[model samples]
Target: MRLRVQGLPTAAGVTRVLSLLAVVAAVGLLPWLSGRDPALTVLRARSAEQEPTKEALDAVRSDLGLDAGPLDLLGSWAADLLHGDLGTSWVSGTDVLPSVVSGLQVSLALMGAAFALALLLAAALVAPVLVRGRRSAGAFAAMLAAVPEFLLATVALLVCGVWLGWLPTSGWQGPAYMVLPALALGVPAGGLLGRLVADALPAVLDERWVELWRGAGVSRARISAAALKRVLPQLVPQFGMAAVGLTGGAVAVETVFAVPGIGRTALGAAKSQDLPLLQGAVLALLLLGLVMGAVAAFTRRRLLGPALRDASLALPAARPVRTHPAIPLTLLTVLAVAIGWGLLRDPYTVNTAARLAAPSFSHPLGTDGLGRDVIARLGHGAAPTVGTAAAVCALSLLVALILGFLPGVAAGAADIANALPPVIVGILVAAAAGPGTGGAALAVALISWPPLAAHAAALVQEVRASAFLTAQRAIGASPSWILTRHVLPSVAAPVARHALLRLPGIALALASLGFLGLGAQPPAPEWGLLLDESRAYVERAPWAALAPAVALALLAGLAVSGAAYAQGRRVPRTGGAGSTGSTGKKKEALVEV
Candidate 1:
């Protein structure tokens, strides 16, 4: 049981044991986690492409040695890991590592192309923040931020690949096929980078050296470089996060773009319950993320060196002035009201004669294949989209507060919750409740709360450790009273901020679920479902897809923008509400594709 540095000790053994336990949870528990009998389910899986008779299932189980003990299975997997074998996929019956490598290469290439474009775009956008001001930069970021990668993918496919016949619409054809997917990924990450750089630039620009440089008639480009030098160290964490977020978000993007990547592979593995493939993909992604994070951390320290000793040398806020979410919140409200007005003003009145009409009079966004008013369906979708998001955020916040204060519950819940991704949770809900709007809301909340609770739990732990809480404890305050007055109030701002940040993610998860046929079914006008419906007519009626894609992306952007505005205003010198990059951390949804 001993572990580490060269044959370690008791404490290390405990840690190793815990690590083994996690491995057990991840691999040993997979069969039950799939909500099926492993032998039977694997035999009948979509990937299997055929149903197995009982005798066949038994024979296959015997061949695969599913009768082995959990520990034996673990040992087998350990042996496989030692040999770098991820096991063969049940579907293809080929070596999984090779496919995984191919997928990784695609994902990395896609993300690599994205990273380069992001840097250039970020530089261009941050330029204005240096020479001009944030107004133009902020406005532009908001505009681009409004679009999610999947919607971006659909649009690019509709316009460039399909309508114009300029690019291939499907497959990993070549570098030519990569452009739309890379651009889809790049634009949002670039917007994030620009926002981060802009946030870091203000104080650097305000400094006296900059004034001297300006007075001495230095080129704005050179001056901007100086500002960038000061900003670069602070950007490391955001950059790392952007990369991580992009990787995490790649599942939907890769699937939509028909790109063979780990994200898409993982989703397929999950659906088929391909335990080894799924585990390998998750482990690889987790390791990749860890490496990226380590690099970011090391680079941050190296670049920050002596500057780290000075808080004054850290990145500056977008505006030191108090920021209210009033404008963004107002915008959200106006959108809701407008959508409601549309719903009342004949958005849903269907006309067969107008079916598949292009954008023109009487139907602004044009008619879908169904002849349903495109604008009406989009407008109708807004209610469920916004309402479901609001409800889920509210529920998640409430759950986070309750579980976060209870140490036992928070610790146990976080472990279980983090293990299950939104898609898996949505599928379970879809199975239990059947596909519909109510189940969709529940699915969103079901997938949404775990991470939020984990955040709240950490915050609560920090608060409980503080001197003020200890002092209150010494005064003989009841745990409940202390939790309510101290813990609740202390955690509220962060919980609120976290909720705001998670909303768009939740929205996207809902959309992804709906895309997979687990949410509101077709003809329901749910934005995500609308995308599903529009896929068939995308070539002939591109606007069918275009309308929902635009609306949904904008909704995500506005939600995120609201969170960003709150973070800008609320993050203070005390650093109480987590990193300034809090919103950016969860902005994974937009770029995740």
Candidate 2:
């Protein structure tokens, strides 16, 4: 047997190193760019009563080495990072390394548990779809995947902790405390991974090898194993994405459960404007994400094995095909009705007498603790929440298309951006621009384009490889003509479909940040802001929380359904709507015929 080892290309290694440097540079430069006097903020954090006179602020800045220019400070910090020094916390006046290490330990444990749970859930969901060809199960998983981790964390806390009294509500006391947070992070991630697997499997099963295995009387178990092996490599990118999701989702999960993980630590540091601690936290999370991506890449290489040498092999890929319309159509109807009804109510008129009022003729969804109508807030919030999400999606699609057409430009930057989650980006944005809707939108847009870009890039490569494209090239057709007439039509529809599916996720990310006071401010009636406002009064008035929560749930359902319906409705001229080139739908169609 010939043994061969595959490693990341030299270019990729250089790209990664550059990406790391870029992140470190950004972290180092943040305090200087933020405009807020870091010295004053540190003084207040250390001693709130201390008068921030010029002398005091100057002393603190000199002591922290912030008296230098931004580039000089960044260089010094980078030098310290090379020598294993993480600097000192501005808040606690202690070494940042120790705090970061302790928090990293807790966050790593939570992330590991959550990722394991996600895999288990993915396996369970995929097993049924693979064995029984259950499309309904896949559809259900898609909807479940759209749910935000914060919402899951909140519901799990209420049902499993407060209501049933089964698990501890908060704190990092022991394993018991980990369950709720893990469930919150894992379920949605699992659903996403499973959806990808389910969509890819039908095509794999239809491969001639499966028939050959059956004809040779190979055991069902062996055949299934072989099929999974073929499908698994296609999931490497998604696995990395799932890893990012687990870490990013931890911010809200940790906050909701009061887990002393890095996410919460980072959040606290951001709020206090503790540049040292926040820098350490961001670095740690960024490194962890890249490491996970590397691990996934390594696993994919190992899985490919002989396939690496077999140039003629045609590996199966996932495709977006037709799906049943019932679920999506039903979800669309529900959202429309809810939004229309809530539009008629007043969201701003407050009445102290009706505070925490239950559902009645006057207020269908009841009133918040501040006596603002729940349904009205939810209805009014839809425009800002959904409109901003749509804008983010549109911007991401634009970026994806540009990057997709150009092969290598900004690829390293995309890697760096992918390492930072929307929430983490939000922390950075808030540090510089202060918290607001515009900053939140920019933060989300920064990290949201990588996946779509990957999709578009893959599509571009696929189309470029096709015989028709080659034939056109052989003829007198110009590159621009071939691209515009052939490539754009083929690439645009599928990428757009993928971007459409992301609307709910972008909205959720925005809401999660808003829930953490990093997005829309008060009186705006944004869905996430409303949820944040109501969380404190959840026990006193469940309706206030439930109204927005239910509304978010409905929104998730709508996105999933709408994406499915659109994908089902459109017929691609070349490859499938899915970024993956799997012919699962074609396989199913053959079976039906």
Candidate 3:
């Protein structure tokens, strides 16, 4: 009789155990390593003051669990962790876990609100542009991504805090204080999402199913919806990754805004070398990232299964492409109008008047602590924050395109360049240029290189394998001619997509740097500087911090969402009539591409 044994080894149990062990090691060892040198040095310094009696030394050692062996230390830590004892904060003399939990609640609320707002704004902004086939929208989105969140926050703080004197510069108040920070965060995210949708749409257009739907007399709108559904599953993982990065980046952002969130708490802990608090915060963030990742993976698995099962089915016939001429012009007009209206508003006058008078019919958005009109400040602030981001995006994209193109043309050299660290380039450029706009530009340019290189390499590989490219080469066309006529055109969509995808993250990072005093200097209305100034007043008037913090968070959220939306809408159509595969064969499509 055949034994009813399992066919393969059940590695799931082993994997789970190993994963848990890894987590434990990471959480425990990292803090120990970071604190060890400083702790030992402190101990040595203290030893010179007076040699403690052996009994007293032993008592202190036992209290800190320092006398225990490695295994005992690990066991004690694990036990404490399991028992909800996160240890005491060296600085605050309070239980670390409780403080972290309280701080996290505020952070979660801010993050959740900001993220939701961003997603909504992104969808709204991107849908119309994508439906109308505006290529410039993608570029605009990329520009938004290029501006850093720290820079945006700083600008907001300066314009709103200093010039208008409307909002409090630092501290948490309530939901209202979150609006500006959230918007500041969301705008860039929205811009990037818009670009992503634009890029993804072109790919969807080339899919056999889309063509089939069109041939079957389905409306373009319906086909678009179906394509979005298919592409969305793939986007989940990317969104999760972005979210994870945002969590880490949020620390600087919250600190800059002086918001009483986990990020601010984490910063405080880091400064004081509060090992337990720091570790706890890091672990919580890690767990959050893991959960998001798992959800994304599950969604991808489910969506990919059906796509794979329908590999060989013949697609319906293609329909004629529809192009819109007025959409781009109309969008440009709207942007111009919005900017003009903003320029006409005077924030300082509004703030002064509002402070002298109470809330009335004229000031609908209400006055801040200094009696500044919120509407006027937002209007004035929009110019610099949005304009700087636009400039950064354009400059970075240009740099990316140039660098990206190099890899496609010279693979070996490109690979070498790609391997070079961005920090080295940033340092070199910063040294050459002083820490001003010039340095910011250089840093952005350096950071942009890797993404561009990767995209260029992929495009080159794709071009090398394309039938059209091969045919052109076979006919003895000059390399320049082939590249100009065939290769560039084919790779345009992917290149555009990559540029857009990088925008929001780049912008947020740059903004964070600016907030941390590494970017723009004083006298300029930067969000980070405002937060720094407001820290002293945080306990008394939390609204001072809350306002700018919320603004920053919102702007980042919007930028990311917009990019994702844009990517979702774009469908790749080059190389073949409707083939999804790079080899021009019918097969199950995975969401990876």
TM-score per prediction, in order, is 0.75, 0.90, 0.54
How do the residues 1-593 of candidate 1 rate in per-residue lDDT, one tens digit apiece?
A: 84447654444345434643664455544543445556765576534566677788887677666767566676777788778888877665678898888888888888899889888988888877877766467556655655666777778788788778887777897998888888888888888787667655776788889899989999988988878878897678668877776775566678777889887877677666676677677666656565676677688777768657445454443443223677677667866764764586555677788889998767777888768888777778876776787888899889877876665545444433444455544544443345667776785675467566666666666676666666778889899898667677767766676787677767777776776566777667788888978888888888888777766765675665665565555433342322313333332211211
lDDT of 3 by residue, 1-593 (tens): 64535775333434444554754564565334443432332233346465566665665556667566556767777888899888876555579898889888877776676667657766765676447754555555655654454545656766677567777666788765776666566665665565556545655667687678778999977876777666666565556554554554456557657887776675565445565676676566556556666666677667667756434332322222222434434444544453354346555553444443333466533444455543444445444444555566667556555654555333333222222222222322332343444455455554455455555555555566667666777889899897766666555545555656555455444545445544455534344433444455444444444444554555554444444354345454434522223422111111111
Q: Which ten residues in a row have the lowest lDDT in candidate 1?
A: 584-593
Q: In lDDT terms, how accurate is model 2?
A: 0.82
CA RMSD, predictions in order:
6.7, 4.4, 11.9
- Two-way lDDT contest, 2 vs 3, winner: 2
When 2 and 3 are scored with TM-score, the better candidate is: 2
* Residue lDDT tens for model 2, 196-242: 77777877888898899999999888888888888888677678878
The residue-level lDDT of candidate 3 at 63 comes to 61
So what's the TM-score on candidate 3?
0.54
Prediction 1 global C-alpha lDDT? 0.68
Candidate 2: misplaced stretches above 4 Å? 1-16, 306-314, 317-323, 462-490, 572-593
Give RMSD (Å) of candidate 3 vs. truth. 11.9
